[model samples]
Target: MSADDSSATARDSLDGGAATLTTRRLRYLGAALATLVALLHLLDPNHGLLELFALLYANPRVLVFDPRPAAFVVSATALLVGVSLSRNAPNRRPYYVAGIVVALTYVVGYLAWHLTGHGGFLPGREPLLHGVAPVANVVRHLTSDPWAAASMASELGLIATLVALLRRE
Candidate 1:
């Protein structure tokens, strides 16, 4: 074979190798992200059970009612989606997209209340709920509450994974 043919073969092999590596990396990332989100919901100290229903959606006195069960459900679904993607299912792309959507929905929905004048979800932390100043709120959460810090970190992770999914071949 000519020298040019050998070089082309080498380039083709390298391209294939890179694609395989990227696929594996994305799958593992999706799984890990899903697991973290699930853990956060299940182990949340602030929004557990009664705290979620504390306001009782029916009560007119309440401006914000966080249903903890819903959070659990969403988290669990994300976990399942992650597991599916990790297995490299034929429909992995759809699952990844769904997971991103779920994460975005949860984050936006939770922050919406604070933006609409509910103040922070937790008492005495009104300043932390900087809906108008999202960047500041993230900084404060990282410095103040462990749960919020984890949440912020997870959001970053989810965003990263979403970008990867979008760019994947």
Candidate 2:
């Protein structure tokens, strides 16, 4: 293999430090996962770019209270931080930590908002009674809520890959 190719693959630090896929490949996977998460948020059916557009169309002032824009901002920032961490060495731990934190935040935030209340679209709505069953909530998100399923899956993937990358340090 070429020098660059050889260096990129190195010994994977994860999975019992097994000689598996190249570290470079793992990094690529991490980046891809991050991109997926960002895209998922960008295209979120309820709280995505389209929703933002609609909010703006309906009433500019409403944007202040809309969560869609905030989601977009956070997603974009996570993507940037994930990419930055995977790009080079030295002081990368921070980036990995930030990326992980962001992913965790999204996952936790989703569960809290939905599980606790009858969350709704822009202008927001809260759950009146109580949260959903954890098992049922996950199942619904995985099966019925297409956008949510995609986002959650990607966020989980991002977390895994980032952790793998971080271990390489």
Candidate 3:
């Protein structure tokens, strides 16, 4: 091939590679943002915006004989597995499952809070409903207290793993 033709081909290839890298970076950023928001519920557990909304809307009461400690252990284990899976491949299923586990643990914590009538023990509060309706009241009380730090760390780990798995030359 002529030198000019070869040079042009190389430039086009380089441009294509760069574009692909940019797209992957953007996707990773999006995933990280999502994971960050979810994890925030665990880190602050009380004041985070998303957590507050969930607490006000759901009004989940703590179940009698709550099993949060056990749930935490299980969720943590799942998080580790999720991190491993993420490293191997962009396994959406495991990531989603881990997210659900984290969410459920928070639910258990909220239920415990309701049964105990102890706001301090949990993350957020049930908003006051001024004669709105029993249903509204119930809805307002649903809440959970997933640990923000652990959740955030797990999410970050997953993001890192995903990025590594998706990396290309």
Candidate 4:
């Protein structure tokens, strides 16, 4: 259009290039949050990568049996996939929706695992219906453990960022 119109469009944050720039910035934020969640899961002092490192230090072959690390690896991989999809996929809605659901599952799963009597074991473990409540134990654990709390918060932040990206798209 005219020079004046071009100048007005350029100045308007919601217009054309400005709007694209805003979307790009949002993508970057989402990517960073996703990456943070992944790193926290891997490198948190509480467990996983740190423990794995210890195991490696002692004897690489003597790695103890712990399924939790596998779970973290899977979760981190899914988050990384989401980050990739957000940037490059042509039709991202299907993947984005799946990613949102996966993220939600992780958050809810963490709560459920802690709130259930058998925090570690599956299926057969009975619920903690007697004595101290499961919920209380989880709350205490989260409050007392800064690393766990930070990891949970990062997961939440990642979820929110994914939701924002979905809405923007």
Reference-based TM-score of each model:
0.64, 0.70, 0.33, 0.70
- What's model 4's lDDT at 1? 59
Give the candidate order by descending lDDT: 2, 4, 1, 3
For residue 82, model 2's alpha carbon misses the true position, in angstroms, by 4.4
Candidate 4 lDDT tens digits, 36-152? 887877775645676666766876654333445656667777777777866776555566577667667767877877777534446445566346677886787689888878878
Each prediction's Cα RMSD? Answer: 7.6, 5.9, 12.5, 6.7
lDDT of each: 0.61, 0.69, 0.47, 0.68
In model 1, what lDDT does residue 154 have? 85
- With a 3 Å backbone cut-off (N, CA, C), the pairs that clash in candidate 2 are 9-22, 115-131, 117-127, 118-127
Q: Pick the candidate with the highest lDDT.
A: 2
Candidate 3 Cα RMSD (Å): 12.5
Across 1-169, the per-residue lDDT of candidate 2 in tens digits comes to: 5554354356343354454545557767877887788777876777777777787788877755546565676676667666865586545567777788889988887776566543443345544332567556656666877778778888998898889877765
Clashes of 2: 4
Rank by TM-score, highest first: 2, 4, 1, 3
In candidate 1, residue 59 scores what lDDT?
64
Candidate 2 has a TM-score of 0.70
lDDT of 3 at 153: 45
